[model samples]
Target: MGRNTRKRRTPLAAKVVAGAAALAVGGGGLVWANFHASAHEEGPAHHRTRSAAAQVATIDCPDVGQQLSGVPDRARGEVDGELATMDSQITEAYQRLATTRRAQAGDPRFVQNTILGPLKDRRKAIIDRIQLEIDRAGGRADDNLDQLAGCQGRPAEQPQNGDGQNGDGQDGGGQDDGQNQDGGQNQDDNGNGAAGPVADDFIDINDVEPNSRDSENGLAANGDGGSTGTFTTDCGVNENNLFNSDNLIAAPGVDNGAHHVHDYVGNQDNDAFSSDEDLANADTSCRNQGDRSTYYWPVLRLQDGTEEFDANELGGGAEGNVGRILKPAQAELKFVGNQQGDVVAMPKFLRIITGDAKSFTNGDANANSSWSCTGFEDRQVTDKYPLCPEGSQVVRTSNFQSCWDGQNIDSANHRDHMAFVQEDGGCPNGFQAIPQLQVRLVYDIPTPTVENGQVRNPYAVDSFPEQLHKPITDHNDFINVMDEDLMNEVVDCINSGEDCQ
Candidate 1:
C-alpha cells in the first residue's frame, strides 16, 4: 500500500550524558540534541564519535519562494509555477540520495557529483527563468539569485536556532542523565524510507518543564482599550475527509504545491486551481453559512504500515510519506480580540499562512506552531513531537497573525500583508488589529514504543521528504471569506466584550 520500508539497524548501547548541549529548533522552545557522540561505543567515557559525513540526514536548500517578495503581479503566476517545479526537483533529488546509500558509502563524493551538483544546475536554470520573467514584466529582479541555487546536505546533529537552551523554558544542560538529550526516546539514526523522523525527534511530554509565555507575542501595557470578546465557529474536524496535496495560497495553479497532504475544513472547494469566485460560491464544512472561509494544515500519520488511498501516488508514499493517516478527534476554531484594543473586521478573501513549512532548513524565523499533550498544554514544544502519556491525546495549536496591512489582500511572498501583534499588543504603523484566529486540533494516537534506543510505530506529521518530517515544520493556512454583514457582526461582538458564536 505504500513505499517499500527499509531495514533498520539494531541500536547501539544508549548512553546517558547529563546536560550536553541541546539546540532549540524554533522559537516555540523544543530543544534538540546536537551532540555528535556515537551510540555504538562501549566506553565509560562521556563522549563517542561517528563519521560526521555519514550522518548526512536530509537536504538543506534555501527557500527561494520566501525570498521572492518583489516579484511583480504579472509575473507572480509563472514564478510561482517555477518555484513549485523547484520543490519537485528537490524531492526527486532527495529520493535519489536515499536510494543510493550503498553508492555513497563506496565513494565519498558520490552525493556531490551524482545528486547535489545536478540539482544545483537545475535550480540555477529555474532562477534564470524567474529573473527573465520579472524583467520582462518591468520589475527588477535580484541579480544574485545564483547564491540561492546551491544547497548542502544538512547533518543530522546540527543545532537548531543556534541556541544552547531548549524552548520549553529550561536550560539545555540541566536535564537529568536519565532524560533524553533531545527530549525524545533513545537515538536511532536510521529512519523510514531512509528519510527522517528519527527516534530523537520525539520527546516524552512529561519530560518537558512547565513554563508560561504569551502565545501571541508580548503582553499589553494596559487593558483600558482592549477588546475582550470572543467568537467561535463550528467547523467539524475534516470529517468529510477532504484531502489534497495542493496549496492555493502559496503555489496556485500548480498541483501538489504543498508536496504534502493537507486535511481541509470549511470551504469545500480548495485546490491549486480553485479561484476566489469558486471558493465564495462553493459549499462549506463550517456550520455557519456566512463564514465560508477555508482552513487547512498538513495531516499527521502513524508509522504503523497501513495503506490508504494515494499510498503510491505523489505527495504520499511516492514522496517518502507513508503509514496510516490520523484524523483529528477535535477541531476548535476560535476568533478572539486584541489585547490592547478592539479588533476590526477582516477583509473578505484575506489570506494568511501561519508558521513556516520549511522551518527545518530555513531556520525558525517564521515557525509559530506548538505541540503539546491534552492536559499538559502549559508546556508546548516546536521542534520535538510530544510522546503523550496514557489518558492524554496529542495536540497541535496555531495562533494566526492578527494584524492586517489594510491594503493588499495578498502579497508576493504571501506574508507581507499580515503581521503579528506587537509586544505592546498593538498593530504596527499602517496596520490594524483584526480578529485573531486560533486553531486547536487534538488527535487520539497510539503512542509509539521507544525502547533500547529504537522506536516502533512512531507517528509524524507530513512534510517535504527533504525536510525530514520534523515537527518544527508544522504550519497552517487560512482564507477569510465571511460575508460583509457577518464579518461586521463579529467585529461588533468582539468590541462589545461579548462571547458570540
Candidate 2:
C-alpha cells in the first residue's frame, strides 16, 4: 500500500494515551498543557498552564507489539525481530533526550525535531517491514500500524512529599535544585537520574492503604471441587550467576531483547537463540532435574555507586540501569491449585510472561507489580516502590495466570493462550484451569532514606531505559520445560490436596 493510501489516525484516537497533562517541549524545559486536573477523577477537560518546570521524564509511544495479535505464524519471527529493533531505537532516542538539555533549552523544537521525529521515522520503516511480513504470510496486517509510529514526550509526576530536600543532614544541600552541581540533570552515581525512580516514586509502607486482594501473598482458599494442594519447586536464588538480557519467549533470536539484565533461574540454557530442543536438553537449576523450566525476571539494583559487570554495557549503566545488582535474599517458586477446581497439567514448553515490562509508560493495565515490605505483605502496592521500615526486607511478588486455552503453547502476544482466574475463582468459558505459578522474591538491602526531597541509597528494578526503572514495570517470565511425567506428578499432587516439593 502507498503511504498516502494508508488510513490515517484521528488525533489520539487509537494511541495508548495516558495522564491528564500533555507535555509540550520548549525552552529546554517541558511545559505542561493540562487537559484535566487529575487522571483518577472525572473532570471537565480544560486548558491550563503550569509555570513550574516539569521534567521530560520519558518517551511514550504506542505499543505496537501489544496490538499485534494476528501475525501469521510464519511471519512471527521477523515481526518479533523488528519489534526488538524498535525498542533499541527508543532506548537510543531516550539517551539523546536525557543528554541534550542544552540543545533543548536553545531550540524549543529540539526534542521533537531531533529525538522523537527520528525515532518515529525509524519506527515507521520497521513497522512497514512488519506489515510486509504479515501480508506476505497471508495475514491481513492492521491498516493503522503506521498510525502507531508517532511518539511523544511524557513528563514525570512531581514529588509527593511536599518537601523536596536533604534536611539538616550532611551533604546539606537543603533543597534539591533538580540538577547536579555542573548544571546537568541530577542523576544517580550510575547515571539513572533522567530516566527515574524520583523521590516521589517511593512511599513508606505505613502510608499505603491495606487494599491487597484476599488471594494475594499466598494460595487462595480452597473452593468446592478445587485442588487444594500445593507444589513447590526448588530453584536456587540465581547464585550461579545465570544472567542475560535476552527474552526468548517474547523476542527470540534477538540479543538484548529485554534491554535490561535479568536474574535467571531454572533452565540453564535460556536465551534468545535457544530453541525448544536446546531448552529440553539443557542443564537444570531446579533441585528436581525433571523440571527444566526457565524462570527469569529483571534484576534489582541499589543505586549506591557500586558498579556491576554490566555497568558500562548496553543493558546496564550505559542504558541508565546502573548500580550494584542485588542478590535476592530468598527466591520462592510455588505452583498452587486453582480455587475453582482441579487444574490440568500445563503443556510442556508453555511460555508465560506476567506483568508489563513497559508499565511505566504503558500504564498499569497489564502491570502485575506487587511490591511490599516483608512484614507488611498484606499491603502490597503496584506503582510505588515500598519503603520498608528498619529491619524489614523488601518483597516482590508475581502471580502467574492459572488458566489456559488448552491448545496453543503460546500466542502472538505470548498472553492470549493463558488467562487469570475469574472473580468467582473459576477459569473463563473455554479455558482450562492450570497450576498457578507464584513467585516471591525478597531482597535484603539498606533502607533508602527520603528527606528534603532527596533519596539516598535508593533501589530500583532494572528496566528498559525508557521505563525509568519504575516499580510498576517489574515483571517475571517463565517457560515450562518440565517433562510430561513430572508435569503429571505436579497435577496429581495439586489435585490430591497434598503439599509437595
Candidate 3:
C-alpha cells in the first residue's frame, strides 16, 4: 500500500508513531508503520499510523555458526548450500501453507514456522559469522546482508509463483495435502502427524531474545511488587477442553455464526451467551480454595491440519482469522490490592481492563498494555508476538482498577467505572476502593523461531472470529464467582496486607 493509504492521526500520536517507526528500522525492524500509544477506548479503525518511518523488517543473520568468528571464504560453500536448502523448503512449505483448506488442516504459518522457518535459522547461524568477518575486514557487508539472510531475492521478497496456498510464493505443482509427514508437529484433529515434532517445529528461542534485565538484588523486576499487597491465585493446569465448533462467545441475542473458535479456560460453561447471573452460579476450574473467577481468550491453533473453516470464504490472511498464527496456550492471574488496612472484595460482576484488548500493536498501545517475558515488566514491547525466553513462561499481565465508582459494575465506555491507582499506587478518595486484579496468563510455549531474526507477519485481533475473539488486543472478563464466605476471606487477606495464594 502507498503512504497515502494511511489516514493521518492526531499530532501526538503521529510523533510517537514516527519515532517508533524510525526505532523499528534502526533497532527492531517493523513494517511500514508501527502502533503508538493510544487510548484503550480507541477502536482498531483508529489504530496504527501509516508513517513511512517504519522500516520494512530487516533480516539479521545468525551469529556464531559452528565457529566463534570467521571470514566469508571459509564458509561460502556451507552458507550457499544452506541457502539453497532454505529456498527449497520455503517453496515447499509455502505451497502447503497456501493450499491447506481446513482450519483443522492448520494455517499456512504452521508450515512456515515449523518447516521453512528452521531453514532460515540454520542459515543465519552460519551467515552471521561470514557477515561479521566481512565487517571485521573493514568493508561493510550491507550489500550482502539480504542475500546472506537466505532471501530468495531481496529482503521481504521471496520467490513467488503467486498462486500458491495462503499467498505462499509457490504456484501449481507445489501444493501438498497439508500433511506434515515429518513427525507429530502440528497435527490435524485426525492426528495424522502424530509423532513428536522435530526441532524445526518449535519457535527458535534465539530469534525472539528475552530481556535479561534484573532489578533489585537479582530478582526479576515485577510491575507490582511488595510495594503493594497482592492476591495471587493458583490457576492450575490448562483444564479447558479442545475448542470445538460449539464454544461460542456471542453477544446477547447474537449467534456464533460469524465468529471463529476460541479456546476457553476458567468456567467451562462460560460463553458469550453467559450472563452475570449465569456466571455467578457457574463453577470454576481454579485450584485455589473457593475462588470461582472466570477467564478465557482466543485459542491459538497449531495450524498443522485442516479445520471446519473454509478457505474460499471469509477466512485466510486478508479476510477472516483463517491463516492466523496463534499464541501459546495458557493463562495465569493475580489480584494486586492496596496497602489500605484491608482491601475489600471487588464487587461481583465488575468487568475490568488489564492490557488493552483493543491495543493490537506493541508500540503506542503498549504504554499500558502488551505482552512481556517473565521477570521483565519494565521492558515490555508492543510486538503482538513477542518471543518469550526458552524455559520461561509467556506472561500476559492485565492490571485492573483498585478504585471503582461503586455504582456501576460496567460503564458506557466499559472504562468509566474504574480509575488507575494513584501515582503512589493508592486508590483515590470518593471512588470505592477494591482489590486491584492483575491477571497473568503464562503459556508453556517454546520460543517461536524467526527467520533472519525478523518477525515477517504478526497476527492481530481481527485474525479470529469477529463476534467473539479479538487478536492480540486481549482483555478478559471476570465475574467474581467466589462464595460470599470466600470473598470475605479474600478481602481480609488484602486488607490485612497478608499474602494469600
Top-down TM-score ranking: 2, 1, 3
lDDT of 2 by residue, 1-501 (tens): 000111222212112111111233222112122111111112432111111114435677778888887778899898888888788777766656655555555566777777777778888999999999999999999988887887776555522221112111111111223343224433232124455556777899999888654553233434666898889999899877877767889888776778788888898887778889989999998999999999999999876555577654556665666667887999999988888778899998999998989876676667788899888988988888888999999999998988899998988778888887877788889999999899999999787777655566678898987776778889999999999988999999999999999
Which 10 consecutive positions of candidate 3 have the poorest summed lDDT?
A: 189-198
lDDT of 1 at 271: 80
The superposed Cα distance between candidate 1 and the true structure at residue 228, in angstroms, equals: 1.1
What is the per-residue lDDT of model 1 for residues 367-436, given as tens digits with 9 covering 90 to 100? 8868999999888887889999999999998888889999878888899889888877788999999998
| TM-score per candidate, chains pooled | 0.82, 0.83, 0.48
Pitting candidate 1 against candidate 3, the one with the higher TM-score is: 1
RMSD after CA superposition, every candidate: 11.2, 12.4, 21.3
Off by over 4 Å in 1: 1-56, 160-191, 212-225
